[model samples]
Target: MRQPLFVTALAATAIALAAAANLPEPSADIKAAVAASTRTPANLARDQYRHPAETLSFFGVKPTDTVVEIWPGGGWYTEILAPLTKGKGTYYAASPWPDGNKGVQNKQTADAATYGHVKFAAFPWAEGQPKVPDGTADVVLTFRNVHNWRMGYQRGGTDYSGEAFAQMFAMLKPGGTLGIVDHRLPESASDDREKSSGYIKVSTIRRLAEAAGFEFVGASEINANAKDTADWPKGVWTLPPSLSQKDVDREKYVAIGESDRMTLRFRKPR
Candidate 1:
């Protein structure tokens, strides 16, 4: 299906503006890694909707760069990132205290066993938590986790989203890329109400990143779903995968498919 004219124009403008930027190009090795046999059929089925290759390319990911993935729940992207960075660079899975959660623990163990040399970083959810070393990473990526981080803004007794962005900024080397993918709310949406809705305004996200001292690079509509109305009984999770409402209007939600997402890239100033 052809994209809407506005989206196409935005992409074209971004490409033209960044024409001189030495963005990383995908290689045969990265392609082979993505197509590796270790991936499950169920996970592979979501590729059409996710467009991992194009998204990763947009973020300027390379084989030999230190990358940190924040809140890798279930390690969906980890499955691809581990192999791609295995022999050359480094991959760190950062999450908030994995010890208590059985699922997170199991994922960490399985990742260690399946992909040797994978590292773990403790995401600071509490006071006095050790931070990832300063200026250490080449790229930092987060997917669909921004809303969750926003939920912690006050609930966690601290500004969670603010601190998280600051941490990601401190961890990256000067000029490193920060890639984010999250369900996008309309520009007019209320910021306070965004937590329960599981969607965020692109402007709000930009404000947080800029507060943490990042320069907005560009955005992509690779994960945009025109069918999504962003107004559902169960918010963004009403759509597929989460299907939070269970059997209620399952077909309708499934037809609408995933939530429309904003793919944004930011850079730490050199």
Candidate 2:
């Protein structure tokens, strides 16, 4: 009986120590900033787009690094990133056109006002190619936007997907991370399917990153939705949020929620 009691006490002590190790040091200022910014309905909805804690954690963001969020649409992550790095880190939003034509500029402007330190840089697709300085960014992130480049919208006769990956690879310092999240296509699908379905095979993304000089670290299923059949008639846009087939089967699509996304982490070789 005494042996069992001793073992139990030891286990409890170990558990307590582990919990203490994992707890982040609370910052009252960060909490206050997040509270102030998320008061609006728009900000609230944007935060709901993904699991904030999980997404930010996956990026390995701390309060003392220079992080760049590529194509930060409506500044969804911007809302979280600004406060997470409020006092110490720098957050830069890179995009094309400062004219606010594609909603990029507007989001950047709004984030700048709220975050104060959030900066913006022009990375126009029409400029032929992106050129980010080497060993500059500590963390480069792009969420659910790779499919747009795959579709060749404004890629300017270049494989924008490949070019974007290369640019990210170049921008990161040795040992820096590149976090990507995108709607996943069925593994059996081909590259051609991306044009129609707005999804790309996970393997294809891995290969692209590897080709662009990144080491594929691993992937997460944190945002995986097993219910998605990957057979929507209108592609991923047929699902919730975008709901391209609004009048046809709005309820069915709404029930489906968002597409299953592949969460990937890649590292620039040190």
Candidate 3:
């Protein structure tokens, strides 16, 4: 049955609103953070592909929010997030290896003046007491770490990825957001590829998040790359940055740049 014109118009408007830009432009603080001089030139160069400003804006980060970054390998986002939250907010580099993970630790230590306010929290979470505390964080961001969590578990004493999602869910305030960016595997790809290659299916990610009590808020293509094929002899590492296949097809992989990625956001229901 056809609805009345007013009802139909309202329905269309709702759909359009849902499809529009989920959040506003990054605040001046975030833009300044991206342009901060503390960041190394090499890390700055990757800005074209990473689009740190746009991604964080889409995640709805604010200077006053308490943010946690999961498994911040090499502290790539730390250069921006740490100082962005400094003085006005709290930023925690949540890692499984608090003391052992040198990448973020060294980055924090080396730039104490800038990252001085940054805190470290054990992720995969400790048993005694939760590090960040349940229902406390305003935002939790994980960049390209989902596949590693899936791979870390052997045959299945426990599911690391599932646990990670549950922990993240617990640590978020009701209505808080979780932003994720990871290599995307096409829905057409075989399931086994997710276990071997660094790429993961969007469905798998949604299932994990939803099961952990998060509602799918929206997705963005801000970090999408048309050049990547998501197939390599040595997996996604065969691409630049890692370039695991060094010199074999260095030119080819360099041209491809980074893997195609999915940017997703979920909300802990209020």
Candidate 4:
């Protein structure tokens, strides 16, 4: 039987994006980690779109380097990362506060075997000191978080996004990699959308990273979702995972899967 048009289209998008990203093939350990049983089944199901193994490989994450993940909302990637870096390296989940994310905290206690060694702490906010020691981290990763940083500043008085980049820079070793993945807004979209919509422009992120003294490393489309146009009743959340619109056009948005994302890599000067 012939394949459906939508399926063919999505496959084409993945192919083109992968080519554009120049993503490295996943290392054996990285692939095994992503496939590890420690990861949540729900999170694993999303791997079709997230491509965790390839994405991390693209960022050059290793087993022997200290890694700090900023704002690991509910420990999606944390499930894979914490165990991957165990013993050989360190994994830190830096958020606003540990109490703020009790879900991960409880998981740490309940599943000590996987999360016991993971360090959970506060992110350096509003000129605060970085919880991750300065000049020590080899890789700092943030997934789908840049938009929330914009929201923080737009709603509050602080420039959280700007501060986040600077703080990340402070914690990284020279030649350290800063890997960021977030929903992508079209460059043609009005600037105001960035504050409300969950999507951010690639230029905006590049500007912030460059301002923080990071050298642009490269980009990967390992998480791109072309069906999403970034114009939703509830922004990027209108897609799967959140589906903020509820049953209204549910199938339509579900067909779109996740939001289109820009996977960016930057480096601190050696």
Off by over 4 Å in 1: 1-25, 100-113, 125-130, 153-159
Off by over 4 Å in 4: 1-21, 125-130, 153-158
What is the Cα-based lDDT of residue 196 in candidate 3?
Answer: 76
Every model's TM-score: 0.84, 0.79, 0.88, 0.89
lDDT of 3: 0.82
* Model 2: per-residue Cα lDDT over 11-112, one tens digit each: 344334334535233244333333443434455443333544445555576668888888887766776677777678877777765642244355445655
Clashing pairs in 1: none
lDDT of each: 0.77, 0.70, 0.82, 0.83
Poorest lDDT segment (10 consecutive residues) of candidate 4: 1-10
Tens digit of per-residue lDDT, candidate 1, span 1-270: 333454334334334433434434445555555565555556655765676666788888988999998888777787778778878999887777744223445655665655666677777545565446789999999999888878763356333788889889989999999999999998876776687788888998999999999999998877788888787887888998899999998998888888899999999999
List model 3 lDDT by residue over 166-195, tens digit each. Answer: 999999999999999999999999988877
* After superposition, candidate 3 runs with Cα above 4 Å error: 1-23, 153-158
Score candidate 2 by TM-score against the native. 0.79
The total of clashing pairs for model 2 equals 0
Error of 2 at 46 (Å): 6.0
